[model samples]
Target: MGGLLGVLLVWRVASALFGGGEPGLPSGGGTPASPTPTDDGGNGVPASTVEVAEDFPLPAIGTRLEFKILGLGDDPKRCEAVGLLVGDDQRTAYHHLCGDAEAGTDVYFFLVRIVNHSDAAQPIALASFEMTADGGDTLPALDVETANATREHYFPERIELGPDSRIKKFVAFDGSPPFTPARLTYVDGTQALVIHLRGTWIGA
Candidate 1:
């Protein structure tokens, strides 16, 4: 009985850490491919390498996207109000379930802006947004309820932008340890845009 109880406890802890006990997280799956330049498949979106200062272009849809990390101590009031405020029960539950409690991982937020520079309206499928850790784990953004709370713009599921129009929002991803590199990618069937992330500093 003692041995069986110990085994169950270990399983429970593992389930909490990586087995998708948290809402909006996918269940365990194979590790994702590490972010790297891929050959252009004739879709007009080239595989480009860029620093944080560069804007990744996706001309196939006549739009450009920019991503910026909300660095340490740069917390926004909306982010604080959205249940991610330090010591909030929701955030604590996330850290205990979806995060690496021992390694102090939680969630990190980023600001993303998409601009349509073409002569006509351009449509975007926001569901294609995803982030991959250097460790090869695919981190899904929190569900719309939690993620959209961080900004008035509110991340949308799909949208069409008029010429010279732009939309920006805050997206929250499962956090990693300090300096754990990651990449956020927006890949639809025809075009792909990549944003190289320098890693996050916030911990549980």
Candidate 2:
């Protein structure tokens, strides 16, 4: 989880560094977050090499996406590099998150990772789903429609990639308030799950 937390810390710092605020940012009312940015240099990787995989499938009924973590790391929060290959498909991105377990901390650990690749803010919802791990033990699927117990939307006030100096790295925040979650459709084309799972449901 250390790696994930580091990534989250990077987000918090990057967001602040790049100024992802409303006129300033959403957390202007809270205690002045005195977050510090460590590591003057990055992981020896060029910023130009940073890539955004655009073909990863959004979780929708009738859509079954297969992925495997090519690398796994832990630093308080876990870091996972997921690999994906489909019928002649080779596009992919690293799904990273930071997990923390402090009582009443109100932090999100990227329970699931997603990217914004749409021009217009598209409507996507999560369904409470059942996923099998290794064998048969089932867990909440990443994105289920009606059954989805959580939801988050990404309508960035800006989307210029690195145009906003505030977006220093691949950053994500959990449960920003006033979030309007979308609905979902079942595989059979029927409505199965419905309702808005609050930000707390997804952690944040």
Q: Which candidate wins on lDDT?
A: 1
- Provide C-alpha RMSD values for all models, in order: 14.1, 19.5
Candidate 1 lDDT over residue span 62-178, tens digit each: 124322222222223222211223222122111212212333444544445666656777676656667766676665554444321323434666777787877756455544443
| TM-score result, candidate 2 | 0.24
Tens-place lDDT digits, model 2, residues 170-189: 21322222122222111111
**Backbone clashes in model 2:** 25
lDDT of each: 0.40, 0.24
Instruction: Report the number of clashing residue pairs per model.
Output: 1, 25
